[model samples]
Target: MNSSLFAVIMMLAVLIPSGMQAQAPATYYNSAYGKSGKALKTELHEIIKSGYVTKSYDFLYTIYEESDTRPDGKLWDMYSTCTWTHGQKKCGNYSTVCDCYNREHSIPQSWFNERSPMVSDAHHIYPTDGRVNGQRGNDPFGECANGTTLTNGLGRSGSSTFPGYSGRVFEPVDEYKGDFARTYFYFVTRYEDLMSTFSTSSTSFSGNAYPSLNSWSIALFLKWHRQDPVSEKEIVRNNAVYKHQKNRNAFIDHPILAEHIWGTLQGSAWDVTGVETPAELLARVNYNANERSMMVAADLGELSYEVVNISGVRLLSGTLLGGDAVSMGSLKPGVYFFRANADTLKAVKKFIVQ
Candidate 1:
């Protein structure tokens, strides 16, 4: 073959493969066009259902070592900060915190009677310490308060501390709260049809597609979702799961979809072909600690702003002529939302006060 022709062929080979790799996610998301609310949820369920590769329950031990590994190449055990080994770390008998890492169903299997698909779904199953898993057994996720029973530093299980809940509950550390929230989002969306059959042991889920989460659980999970955002671990695990299951968790790819579905930013119009541009801009708002202010670049001529705590308590509110700043006041350090409202546009952005 001629040298020029051979070079052109080689370039085509590299560019073709690279282009496909880059467009894979967009291609997968294309099926969700013109979808929102329950329609969107159901569409995603169908889109993801096709590529599922079911594995036996025992296979999760090997899978977790790869899918949940941390930055240091160690097993990512959420129940405790232990350096768990791959094959040897299977739980046999554990009486302590870091004894072994085992498969934990973030959504208790008993809720679905240990059925297929949901039982082994990697989205809700995690690699957690066995002892802590036992502590969290069958208890729904919630904040624990009085009558605390277990505290492994990475997790707590006890009587409910959250409002509107009065049952034994399990709460993972703050670092993994968003992880669990996104997983729960995936579970509900992927299995929207089956939700009605699963037992609502906790008030967290409502067993329906639209407004799939209860009021209190929506508040709690939304808070965690905004606070934690998506991390490198989540992205990597998302891709790994896609490789194994042939399906992707849409929320991990598009976090703003959570808000569009059931949280604060619900009812905002979004582009079904891709991620919402307005939500992306809102998420990128800058927080200036030195100025004690938050700002987003938008041309909303005359707008009002409000700073609210995670519990929906209004801390500060005022009007802003375009480009004017809103003071952070003497509010204590914690996660807060900065909401901007105009004639027809409204946006909510989350920022942390250190």
Candidate 2:
């Protein structure tokens, strides 16, 4: 933990309220309200693409310094456990895992003919280990069986064991499955207009704007998105990328948007208006000091919860089951908070985490 990064985190801890929700600036989704299904996706695509600021491929390196910085100040590389210093070590040659870092396009560049705009879109371009990025080699994400593990034991490459697809795939660390899943959602929606014209394509594309994702991808991504809810790491990174890109990942801001467009709530009109956020649901919940545990309010239905310190860094995250006590275990004395998706009930709590 370098002094500067530690200081920045501590300062953020104090400045960001424990219960504050990470969402858009009030009306960013205004145009999509009350729309559902394909109409909602089209409106959101218009909103994001219009707000986007164009930059170059090389400029992505500059953006990585901020977007991928870990809490410990090292570059946050998902593929390998390399403690990288931003702007210092870049991919030139690599014989092993920790050789250097490079940009990983979650969606392969070849699928879109390595063209501009999509080629440099920061939303899916990640800072990752060079060697593992090579290993992943544009393989679509999926669960694996009898796989060759990547640099870290956290990821793997092999035949897909995920229900729908049986092709070769690359599975990232469990911690980042949802991150990548939502990133896919953003890519499909933000670029819905350009689908047909792409130079090449993957099996994941449905060849139309309505349900841009293939059936297999639709099921796989929905599962990943639900199991791995958004984290403080994602929220911070989302804000950082928006600083340079001028557009935000709507899935990160409002995860439920995915449901309206493709999942369980597909036909329901998307209405963010007049919605009471999780902060407003605090009255229905309470902390159990003796149990050292938590859960979403019974009325909110099941959800995923994030526990964090006064500073917004995440401490723990898991399924927010039926109001049954979920053990939080030990913690240093300080004000901590518990929160869930703003799209789902928005149940949050401010309590001394211990």
The top-ranked prediction according to lDDT is 2
lDDT string for model 2 (142-219, tens) is 888688875453588889998868888898876688899989999889899888765334456777776888888899
Candidate 2 — which pairs collide? 13-311, 278-346
In order, the Cα lDDT scores of the candidates are 0.69, 0.75
Off by over 4 Å in 2: 1-23, 199-202, 273-354
* Candidate 1: segments with Cα more than 4 A from true spot: 1-24, 146-152, 272-354
The numbered model that scores best in TM-score is 2
How good is model 1 by TM-score? 0.70
